[model samples]
Target: MRKRLDFLSLNFLRKIEIRYRLINCFILVSLLPLLISGLLAYGETSSATQEKVRVYSMQVVKQISQNLLLRMEKIEDTSEELALSDRLQNLLTDYYGSDEAASAQARSGISKVLLDSYGSFPYVNQKYILDRKRQVIDPQIFAPLANSVARLAEEAPDLNGRPWWTLYNAGHGQRSLAMLREIRFTGNNRSAGLLFVGVRPSYFFRIFEGIDLGYDSSIFIVDANDGAIVVQNRETGPGNADPALQQGIAASLAQKRDADFIAYTGADKMPYYAAIARVPHTSWLVVSATPSDKLNADTRSVRNKILGIGLLCFAVSLLLSAIIARSITQPLKRLVMVMKETESGNSRIRVEQAGSDEIAVLARKFNEMASKLHQNKEQLEDQVAVRTRELERANRKLEALSATDGLTGVANRRRFDEALATELRRAARSNKPLALLMLDVDYFKKYNDRYGHQAGDECLRIVARVLQKSSRRATDLVARYGGEEFIIVVAESDPGGAIQQAENICDAIFELKIPHADSPFGYITASIGVAALQPDDHTAPERVLRIADQALYHAKYQGRNRVVLGSDTVHTL
Candidate 1:
């Protein structure tokens, strides 16, 4: 029997025995979860980190966008104020006067004013004002253009007296932001002349000088209409942005005028987090492309540590499993049952260690291995919890950011739509009244023309605040609809309540006494159209919007600054 047993053991050892299988299984099972979990942890951490970076980057983009807009508005205001000069306006109004000497003196004075204003600005490259008669007060200022002011006058857009921002060649073949506005007289809104102001590329550098967007970031302003890069950070960063990357950024901005930052690999094999925000009242988008290597550094560090620890543990555990498996043949069945139990999540199940022999040593090894594996499991769970909390935090921030308008600090158009839909659904379920009011600043274009875009923005913000203050209910939503338009959603309000609310808003705006030279009230006023509905399950939000918008049109048609109800006759104030 001893001879037979010895022969069998030798043959079994020569073959691939249970001991070898145990070692292989232990090595594979131990390393596989470590590898998979390390990869998954890396993936999750990277994704979470990227999202946090994106949110942070978007916040930065929003800030720089505000800075750029304020600066651009300052430039525009300077140009408009200079153009609106009573002396300049009078000179251009009587451009064809018989007294050439006086006209020349007036032209010289106007030139002095423009030079004193825009010329003092380090960014101004060209400044000229022209009338419909195709004559420039100062020919030298308009001489650089081969097409002349006539072409500009012809090709320029007429946006109801609002300035048209376009690109211009500021000598030496550098293109820059140019503003062309049909300057008009304060009264009657008559077009007196056109003002053309071209800024140098330094204009971009001036505003973006102190803005830091990490290392090697490219911050640029792009034209939304033509996907033209108006200006980029050339003096400090990369001389020129990659064409494909710029185009991709343009395309992404085109998809949505205001978008959150996103991560993508560039054609150059470099990863970037791109963010975009629209400059108010212009077709320009402020885009920032920041490198993403730093965003992944933390995750890579964690993954490397995990990989090293996992590999070391795998080697040590594999060696111990082979030794334990070979010596514990007598209790292999019981050990296999215990391993199966541990595999099935019974980590506390222990192998009893007894006697001073190899079997006892094997049992101790198994117990130690189980204890270590359980520890790894607990650590992985902690990591998952941390990652989950991080993801939750990011989502909360995103929700807050997405729901507010960047300009007025009110709910944006998207948030407004969502609120309207949600309220409509609630109204449908409860069979309650829901009111939607579309409000517009009376003669806003004229206001912009008179006060410049900066004032217009301030006016909108003031109006938004008033509307926000007027909303007494928690269900009320005030949002900037677009341009100089604002929309309000009042839940559980009747037509009378909604109209009273609109009238209150109008009175509040009127009392503010914000001057408006073009308005009849001589101050900023609102024209509100109220549409109140007892929405059923079948009612559509768009239908309510159309009715309210139509009512708003009628209110403006009935002479502005009044509330008009959708289903009622003209109730003028």
Candidate 2:
């Protein structure tokens, strides 16, 4: 009986001990900390997600605005360039009251340039030039708009000598955007005529290509002066465009409320997040609207996840608190050290995932993150290097194309002008003599008349090669001044050396034996004018060019195939 009693006592004590341990665990692990932690995590994650969405939406709107501004600026710049071009200006200035052939020539040059410029920009639907006589150079362009709006662009008092934008109705309720620029003679800076550019609404479709936001989100451009939609995304249709929403947005933007997102309530009583950015150089605003529910959807998902994670962590902690002991501390410390190492620019550092517990999972995630970061760093570095190299190559190619003539493979007129100025400056400073040779094919117009223009071009190319070979010094420059006209600059050369070089150039062309039935020699030949001068600091490069030109005329007058010094003394080659 005593043994049976002792067994019962032992069983009772064991039951009590089990109950006590259960109470202790519950008290120690309590749901309070879990609820508090879940709430904190939910709050932090929601705020972060909301902030990120806000920033991302604003960036999208700003990017759209920047892109629109860039295209507008390009158009504006092209217009400025066309208006300021000397050849085009001369053509336009002479277009009025000119003969048919002259007018035809002017139109040809103008059209070629306009088409080439237009081809680079597909957004420009239609381009035309309205001359001083109010005649459209190109027929397919809008003549009526050119006659009316183009004139307004030139004479309107409200424009303040700036470009004007208008919306043209293209029937079927489709509208097109138009920019009108007043062309002026660069010589006089007075209004000469107008340049017209048209852009259809289709441009916007391509402008927003590859750009995406969440559902029910839309971006559009509107006139800042008046709330008129210039371009709208597909989502912002007539149904979605609420007058109340528009007015509220306009009001918010008018107040210059902030350079970030604003809260707006639409007519349907649904709240929206709106962002606005101004399109540079235009009275347009890029506006983006996102539904509040959609914007917060990510935050809501994070909140639910936080709650679940907190619950799971609470259960796991309760089970492992006593056994985990100091194991968690060491790995966590190691993880912290590795993170510090990664933060200190060592993305190759990784944590070991020794087990399948939460700590091990965390370590595995850290390792994965580090590996991805390292890969991304390498990839970004490679892309940057490649892009830098490509950009450098593109820039070099552009520079070469800009400075070199295409037809003759020599310096272009612009490059010649630049080099002449620099060389003159150098000679003036060093007190040295510089020589210039200006020459043209004898009876070149007759050559073009006898042979076709293509033959004439080939002859000119061959002549350029001969001139380049004659000027052997590295400091010498050979350039095509214009059609059938080439110029050579001999650095640090006296008049005698220049005359010798000119004679050589003349003899080389004569030896080519190219067919020129119209010439006195019955072969291709050249007339060169030599000008050498020790120019002072005040000497203009134009003065040297003018002297060379005068000598060239004297050479032509004296004989067909000879060289003339600056003093008009002829040297038979």
RMSD of each: 16.2, 14.4
- TM-scores, all models, native as reference: 0.46, 0.44
- Residues 1-573, candidate 1, lDDT per residue (tens digit)? 656554443334334445465666555565667778799889988888777767766777687778877777887777777767786777765564688776676676666566556634546767777766655667434244635545766777665867788776554456667788777777667767778887766666666777776646777877766667777766642234456566676667667757656557877788877887777778777778877886577779989898878776665565444444444464566678899999999999998664445455777899999989887998999999999999999999999989999999999989998999999999999888999999999889779879999998999999999999999888899999888999999999998888888999999999999998888889999999999889988888878987787788679767899999997556677
For residue 56, give model 2's deviation from the true position in Å: 3.1
Candidate 1 residues lying further than 4 Å off, grouped into runs, are 1-30, 141-150, 236-257, 261-273, 291-298, 309-573
Candidate 2, TM-score vs. the true structure? 0.44
Q: Per-residue lDDT for 381-498 in model 2, tens only?
A: 9999999999999999999999888999999999999989999999999999999999989988779879989999999999999988988788889999887899999989998888
Per-candidate count of clashing residue pairs (backbone under 3 Å): 0, 0
Model 1 scores a TM of 0.46
